[model samples]
Target: MKPGEFAGKTAVITGAGRGIGEALAKTLCREGMHVVAGDIKKESVERWKESFPEQEILAVSCDVTKAEDCEALVQTALDRFGQLDYVISNAGILHSGAVDEIDPAVWKQVIEVNLYGTFHMIRAAAPVMKAQRHGVIVSMNSKSGKKGSYKSSAYAASKFGALGLVQSAALELAEYQVRVNAICPGNLMDSPLWTEGENALGIQYARNRGITTEECRAMYDRQVPLGRTCRYEDISNVLLFLLSDDSGYITGQALNVTGGFEMR
Candidate 1:
């Protein structure tokens, strides 16, 4: 983006505590936009205040699974910035297992967060964007949304539903000058979602495939036509375009940044 192109604009982001969400929040804040960053963890959100006192950021405790919390987040952005120019729905969770083996509750939790959470966010922000008559809404989707993964039924289902939401919301909000879209990233191997914690996607995929983690990573890398995994910068670049005037004519697209994986 041009220097200060987004300056003075305001944005709201969900799941701003870590990984892609945190990176997105930092990017906007650095671009001189007022960002209301919301995370489920109180301590995680609080860090934003201490980290970027010079930037305008309202870090709020939010659980996207709840509509009230979602509404509160949008209201916070309006109360602080007077107008909301962008809303990035980045909050999501993943759990992979066969339909017969995975606990029903575990499968349901993924849907609740990745799917229901997105619905709540859109339901809360759409009205405001409609009222303002101009806004950009981007959802952090994945290639799994387009095709089913071997054992990631829940994750794929949530994302597929999210795509429907993005498209339908685009149609509903387009008349009001609100653009709604989704970015389907291939995979950020280095991201905490894949690498960190005991329940990381990397570990789950490796286990389900009967391969070592490194082997699983290598397999995915080789599958990408780009011969590499997706990166945060790749996603952020697409996101910036979707938020800019250059893409003012684009809406309801689930643009693929998958190195041709999704196309295949």
Candidate 2:
């Protein structure tokens, strides 16, 4: 779609504190849309508010894991813009470990944050969109959702559940002019979600396989036929398309932005 088509539109993006969520929010704001940027951390929301003081952006703290917080997120958008045009269920967390050794608490935490978080966001937005009879919902899934990983039982399962939500919600919301879809990306660099613990996990894997950290990273790229890793912009391009009227015909589909890492 041409730029500024979203000028008067309003968007609600969960997990907008950092990484892909932050990038998506900035892009939409640049496109002239009023944005309700929600994150669990009040500081992160405040940081965004300060960074883009010129734009019509509302920053709020929202924990997607809580149903009430999800309700407040939708309310914030309506209170600010008087309507909602798009919703991005982008809040997520990752926990990687072998199935046998993974702690139950860790597994439950991943599901709660990633899977249930998506559900809560959608549940809160559906009624608002249905009442208006027009809306778009884009979910941030992962390539791991498409296939199992060596040591990512919880992470993979959570993402898989997210895709399920995307597909099911798409079918149910279609008649209401509410489009729902998902984007599955592979290993993004410099994302806030990739904590030092994740790095250590990679390093440990590298050591076990007798390869350097660089090699380990490269090994991941090699899995993708595209012969390269994806950057933040790569994912953003897809999200922009999905949110725009250009993708109005698209729904109930999960687009892969994984550089051919996982093909259907």
Candidate 3:
């Protein structure tokens, strides 16, 4: 994006405490946009605020699964910045298990956060954007949304729902000049989403497959034609385009940043 292309703009981003969400907050702030960063972890959101002492950043404790919290987040953006130009529904959770072995509650939690959360945010932001007659909404989907994964049924199901939500929202909001899109990223090895705990993808996959995490990582890396996993910056860059006027004509599309992992 041009240096000040987003100056004076404001955005509300979910899951801004870590991973791609954190990267998006920092990038947008540096590019001259005010950001309302929301995360379920209050402490993490506080830390994010501390890091941006000089920028216009509002850290909110938000549970996106709750519609009220989603509304509060959008209200805070308008209260602080007076206008909302973008909504980045980056909040999501991952779960991996065989359909029969997975706890029903686990499946529900994944859907609540990954799919319903997107719905709540968009539902709240849509009216505001529609009234203003201009805005952009981008959700963080996954390559699995386009195809099946070995043990990612729940996560993929939620993402597939989210992509559908994006398409439907795009069609409804386009007449008001609001564009909606989803970004499907492949495995991001360095992200907190995969490296956070024993349950994380790398460690979990390693244990399930009887290999070291390093070996698991190497195996997955070999699957990508680019021979590398995605980076937070890579997804954030696509977000920058979708939010900018450069991609004004694009809407209702699920764009892939998967390094040729899933060509569809």
Sort the predicted structures by lDDT, highest score first: 3, 1, 2
lDDT of 2 by residue, 147-243 (tens): 9877889989999889999999988999999999999998874455542554555566678799987887878778778887778889888998998
Better of 1 and 2 by lDDT: 1
**Model 2 CA lDDT for position 69:** 96
Q: What is the C-alpha RMSD of each candidate to the true structure, in Å?
A: 1.5, 1.8, 1.0
lDDT values for all models: 0.91, 0.86, 0.92
| Candidate 3 structure quality by residue, lDDT tens digits, 187-255 | 999988789977777888889889999999999999999999999888988999999999999999999
Top of the candidates by TM-score = 3
Error of 2 at 143 (Å): 0.5
The TM-scores of all predictions, comma-separated, are: 0.95, 0.93, 0.98
User: RMSD of model 2, in Å?
Assistant: 1.8
Best by lDDT: 3
- The TM-score of candidate 1 is 0.95
Higher TM-score: candidate 1 or 3?
A: 3
Could you give the candidate ranking by TM-score, starting with the highest? 3, 1, 2
Q: Which stretches of candidate 2 lie over 4 Å from their true place?
A: 195-210
Worst 10 residues of 3 by lDDT: 42-51
